[model samples]
Structure formats: structure tokens, C-alpha cells
Target: MTARERQRWAVLGVAAITASIVATRSLVVTDRDRVDRFVDAVSGEVTPGRIDAAMRYLDPDRQPVEITAYEATEAYGPGEREALRQRVRERLRAAAGMRFRVLRKSVTMGARSASVSMQLYSSEGAPSAEYVLRKHGDDWLVETARLR
Candidate 1:
């Protein structure tokens, strides 16, 4: 082969190897990691004025979200997504300066679903919650959030 041809082949080989490495790195994100990332995003989005942004993490299909407080519980399903959103908005407005964080977390991952149990901390109180996530296409969506 000519010198120019050899140089071009070497460049192409390097490019191919680089692409392979990138793809492999992307594929190495395990289910647990995906759940953590999703949760982290949810945590960051739950601000006093970002109710809509926070709700976006919820499944588009309107999976149920169970909220428990003061020994009372309510389940918000497809027909009650708006009510759920309204409730969240009210809480966010009420706790304007409170910070929300996950103090501890445990993850159980299935092939297409995962459960994350998290101890949450906020100015109001420390509560434990379980979040269920389902794989939809290439993304993970919050199927349910049970707050205690």
C-alpha cells in the first residue's frame, strides 16, 4: 500500500477503537446506577417553585403515587395526577426554604423494574419513602412514589 493509504487506514482504525470505547462506557451504566441518577435528578428538581419540573419525573402513563403523612394515606392514580401535582405544589410552596435530600438509599433492581427505598430529610421532618421505577424504552420513569 502507498504511504498515504496506510496513514488513512491507521486513522480509521483509531477512530473505530475510540467509538467502541465510547459505546462500551455508555453500556456499562448498570440498572442501579440508572436508578441513582434518576433519583438524584428528582431530588434536584424538587424545589419550591419547580413543581412541574419535579412532576416530570413521574411516569407519563400516570402510575399511582401514594403519599402518607400524619397517619393518613392517599393514592393518586391516572385520574388524580392533577391532584397529586397540586398537592406537591402546595407542599413546595409551604416549605419554601426547606431542602430535600436523600439521607440513605437501598436499591433492588429487576430486569425492567427497580425499587428504591430512601430515607429522606427535610426541614419539616425525616421520612422514609419507596420509589418504584420502570424502564420505558431507553429511559427510566417513576412508576410510583410512596412517602411515609
Candidate 2:
């Protein structure tokens, strides 16, 4: 091929690769933001005593489930849901001296819902906590937590 033609092809190839990279990066950032927003909502609920606002993210019919630090490896169920929520609130009140904050978050989106994993920081500046969230419609709710 002519030198000019070869150079043109190389430029086009580079442009295509750059575009793909940009698109992929954009998607990753968008996913990250979604998780952040969801975590923020949860934090707001806990901080402001807005349990109703937090419930907006939960599947009303699904019920809350609790998994303690000892049972962190197990799945949560309705039987322990309410007790767990109360325990979390008490712990935050006592240990953190404040409500939770989302330190980092990751999310995966589905057709109409999403799931998030979040690292949460306490008010007392202790090690971060882990929370798993599931989106219900447009809102996100905590499905489980692993406290530190």
C-alpha cells in the first residue's frame, strides 16, 4: 500500500480503539455512580431517622433480613430481619457516634434492577463496613451487611 494510505489506516485503527476505551470507561463510571447514589440514600435514611425514606428502596413485600457478624457467611431471612435492623441502628448510635457513610461502592446493573457492594465508614473513624444492596425499581435497599 502507499505510505499515505497505510498512515490513514493506522490513524483510523487508533481512533477506533480510543473510542472503544472511552465507551467502556464511561460505562464503568456510570455504574459506579449508580452504586454511590444508592448508598447515599441508605446513609440518609439511617442518619436522619428517615426509616420510611429508606424503605422506599426496599421491596415492601420482600421484608428485611439480618445477617450478624457471626452469621455473616450465611444468607439472611425474614425471621431475623427486624432484629438485625434494630441492632444496626443501635450499633451505629453507640459505636460510630454518628450514622454510616459510603466510602466506596461497586455495582452491577440488570435489565431493570441493580446490585451494589459498598464499603462504609463509621463516624468514629474505625475500619470500613461492607454492605450489599439490591435495587427495587428505581431505589436501592440494603440486603445484607458485614460490620467490622
Candidate 3:
């Protein structure tokens, strides 16, 4: 090919690579942003409906471990999970409007899965704790939730 034609091709190739990177970056959700969404979905409201809504973010096939130090792991079906949540619904509702004080948050992308870790305040008090999440398709599913 002519020198001018080769140069034009090189420029086109560089433009294509740069465009690809920008597109991929836009699709990537930062660790902090994902954790913030999790906190908001879980702690924003404390009602039966809201609790169920939060649980929807969990993976039904895998055990979605949720504990508050006082309670035990919750890994049940839709009905059973709601029943278990009912046990703590009353107290949690009292702590509504809970705001999370994020201490640390991170996400690790893997070959076929990704994990999210975050430390934040519990509704009960200021005790910060870390939680785990797993990527299911394009959305992150809660693998474990530790909140009061």
C-alpha cells in the first residue's frame, strides 16, 4: 500500500481502539458506585415490602446469607425468606431512614464471576461490617447481607 494509505489505516486503527476503550469503560460500574447502590437499596427503607424488594437483589439459587449478629443466616425460598425477615421486621422498621457510613468498599472482577466487599454502618449502631455480593449476568446479586 502507498505510505499515505498505510498512515490512514494506522490512524483508523488507533481511533477504533480508543473508541472501544471508551465504550467498555462506560459500561463498567465502579466498586464504590455499586456498593452505594447496594446500601441505598437495603437501608433506605425498612418495611416488609422494602425488605422483600432488597431480597430480590439476592441470588435465589445460592444461599443468600443475611445476618445481624442477633439473627441467623437466611437462605430460604421466597415465602420462607419473607417469613424469616418478618421475625425482625418490627425492630428494623423502627430504625427506618437509616444512613450508611461507608468505611470501605471494593469489587473484584473474575473470569466468570465478580465479588463485591463493603464496610458500612448497621442500622443498629455504628458498628461497621463487610458484606459480599456476586455478579449474576450484568447485575450484582447479594451473596450476604449483614445489617441490623
Highest-scoring model, TM-score: 1
Q: Sorted by TM-score, highest first, which candidate order results?
A: 1, 3, 2
Model 2: per-residue Cα lDDT at residue 69 = 62
Provide the lDDT at 90 for model 1. Answer: 74
lDDT, residue 3, model 2:
100
| lDDT by residue for model 1 (1-148), tens | 9999999999999999999999999879777776777677555335644555456666444455566654767677676766777777776676665666888888888898888888888777887877787787666777667767
> Candidate 3, which ten residues in sequence have the lowest lDDT sum?
70-79
Provide TM-scores for the models. 0.68, 0.46, 0.51
Per-model CA lDDT versus the true structure: 0.72, 0.57, 0.61
Candidate 2 achieves a global lDDT of: 0.57
Give the residue spans of candidate 3 off by over 4 A.
1-36, 43-53, 59-71, 77-79, 84-91, 112-117, 121-124
Error of 1 at 48 (Å): 4.9
Q: Could you tell me how far off, in angstroms, the CA of residue 21 lies in candidate 1 after the best superposition?
A: 3.3
Which whole-number lDDT from 0 to 100 does residue 73 have in model 1? 71
Q: For every model in order, what is the number of clashing pairs?
A: 0, 0, 0
